[model samples]
Target: MVELLAGLSENCVRLLDVAAAGVLLSDGRGVLRLVAASSERTRLLELFQLQRDEGPCLDCFRTGTPVLVPELAATADRWPAFCAAADGVGFRSVHAVPMRLQTTVLGTLGLFGSQVGSLDRSDLDLGQALAHVASVAVVNERAAADSATVNAQLQHALTSRVVLEQAKGVIAHVGDLTVEDAFRVMRRYARDHGRRLGEVAGDVVERRLAGRDLLEHARSVDLLPEE
Candidate 1:
């Protein structure tokens, strides 16, 4: 599986205008860890984005959808920290393709380009194929990792879901709103604050910040309503 992913990354670098390529695998609880990269630069960049909790990769992973940013400089308003950091690294554009099987999303494949341009249809199609391959690689890796405890898979999945639900409640309470409204508020906060919504939600649930304090902080940051 590792060799396959390495081959795919090499193919992506050769076939596309991307300077760097990477695959990220999500643990199903909003945590995406790097699985593979075409080069050291790609790995470093991905880790940087994950640590900062901002970037197209995280967006794609969260939405379970592709994200194509044609011009990093022009999209500064949309992703302030990500744009600045990517530009500093000489990346002018980024594209992220989600790796999904049916309704289950496994991860994301991200491409970084040093030039600015919209991805053509062919590029999009190729990216999707790569994402599919990445998904297969992730599943294989997971199977290998859990080979000793096959029966625990379902339990782990359930626990992850429970944690995610608790995190959602934390967001709702912190924002002083309904669940759906809280999600919207959290998403908006993520966009404006240059952080991932899941990370913020986790912090809320872990009691790192009080619910009322979160509400007040959100208001101060222009993230949510005062009430």
Candidate 2:
């Protein structure tokens, strides 16, 4: 994945109307991390964005849409830290394209340049195309790699699914809730308490976690439906 991201960022600089480029990809849970950059300054700038949790890539990631900044100076008010940082690093413009395929957003492809002009429509289109290609390639590579563990994971998941369902039924019965509400309640507890859903479900299925107790937890967290 790092190799792919590195290559993609390099290509964005070499082939597009940009002086530098950076790539930021999200983990499975949507936390963005710096993947690659075309230059040292660009790398540091990307890191700054990650640390501050602002800038074009972050905005694009949050909206799952492209963030095109034709002129950094013009947009200083919108992203003060980012503009100041870019100026410090000698970047005058930025264009952030969403690295997404369909509804799933993988990350963003951020193009930067020393000049302060926006890319033409054609250039922007090409940038979007490159980002899409990178997204597809990354997804395919991951799918291939995950194939090795797919069987084992599937077996465990199938067994866990049964236990999870049984636990849901138990919670529903004890809480006087529908199965759907029972599932939401269970998931909320696991997430809030820093436990895995499957582990908590296993406990409930094994009678380790009582359904009445689960219901009480939901009520405490205000996760229960209003009567």
Candidate 3:
């Protein structure tokens, strides 16, 4: 996701005719965590805004709207610290577009400029379009990660179930007992030994020493209730 955003930031500088560009994204909980910057100065300016917690991007995220500052000088009264920081970094103007997925605002896409002028209608529209693309990219990346985690968990469950079934069949045949009784005996032994039933069943299928001892113990302990 960072690599894609870095490329998109470069596109902003090239196509939007902006001096520099940076992308800032929140962690879905109103906290900015990721940044894709076109230059070192641009990176510092982004960090400055995050540290002070006051800037065009912050406003854009809060309202789920675009914040365009054509001339940073004119916004001194509104964002005094932000204006000063922009000047320090040699940026004269800035613009912010909301990075949103549906009605949920994720963060902001920031554009920095060396000159003091607003982006025209076409450029402004393009900027917003880029922001939309970035929003979708971030959300989809997160969704893919969550999906992988769920898949791994489901696969583990299926494998364990199969192992347990095989172990039950082995123990039932060895002990001359019903499959259900074999399972109950294994469950009791596992609980007494502070182990999982599947793990104990695995030992039985593998014919390990632990499996031999468990069978002997189960027989002595009574494999089933007497009528």
Candidate 4:
């Protein structure tokens, strides 16, 4: 994932003829972290955005829109800290595009230049298109991970329920009680023993807990449900 973003940022720099570029992603705790950069200088500059909180990437990510600084020298008053830092790093201008998918803003793609100038209309459009693709890729990756977790949980629940039902069947046959009553007996035994319902049920199905023994235990403990 880091390599993918680095490649994309580098390609953006080459395509737009910029001096450097970087990608910043939210850490999901309201802090932005630099995930990729075109150069070591660009990486340091991007990391500084978090500490200073006044860089184009910060603004672009917060507003979910593009931030263009045609001339960094002219923006000292607007972003005193960021402009000073950029100047020290040999950057004359900067442009930042938000990586967004519909209403979700994932991150920002920042471009730096050695000369003061703004991107052309076409270049701005292309930059935004690339950002949008990155946003989709990130969103899809998260969704896939979430789906796998849900599937595993569902499978576990299904397996447990199957064992419980089979245990109830055995209990009903041996105790001469309804399936509902057998389930109540099993549930009570699990609760009293501080054991998981699935574990108790598995024991009954495997004959580790004999049906007749469980039936007698349920009666002695008064666990059977009323008719």
RMSD of each: 14.7, 16.3, 21.6, 22.1
TM-score per prediction, in order, is 0.60, 0.62, 0.61, 0.62
lDDT of 3 by residue, 6-65 (tens): 667889999996999887766533476435677668877888898998889889888999
Higher TM-score: candidate 1 or 2?
2
Q: Give the residue spans of candidate 3 off by over 4 A.
A: 141-227
Superposed Cα deviation of residue 205, candidate 2 (Å): 44
**Worst 10-residue stretch by lDDT in candidate 2?**
149-158
Q: Name the regions of candidate 1 deviating beyond 4 angstroms.
A: 140-227
Error of 2 at 20 (Å): 0.2
Return the lDDT, model 2, position 37. 74
Summing lDDT over every window of 10 consecutive residues in candidate 4, give the lowest-scoring window. Answer: 149-158
Top-scoring candidate (lDDT): 2
- Residue 66 deviation, candidate 3, in Å? 0.4
Decreasing lDDT order of the candidates? 2, 4, 3, 1
State residue 81's C-alpha deviation in candidate 1, in Å.
1.6
How many steric overlaps are in each model, in order? 0, 0, 0, 0
Q: How accurate is candidate 2 locally (lDDT)?
A: 0.79
**What is residue 73's positional error in candidate 3, in angstroms?**
0.7
Report the lDDT tens digits of candidate 4 across residue range 1-227.
43356567878988886888888876445466676677668877887877878888999999998999989999889889989989999999998999865666667999899998988898888888887777666566455345454334334443555677689889989888877677667867876788777788899999898887677667777675333
lDDT of each: 0.70, 0.79, 0.75, 0.77
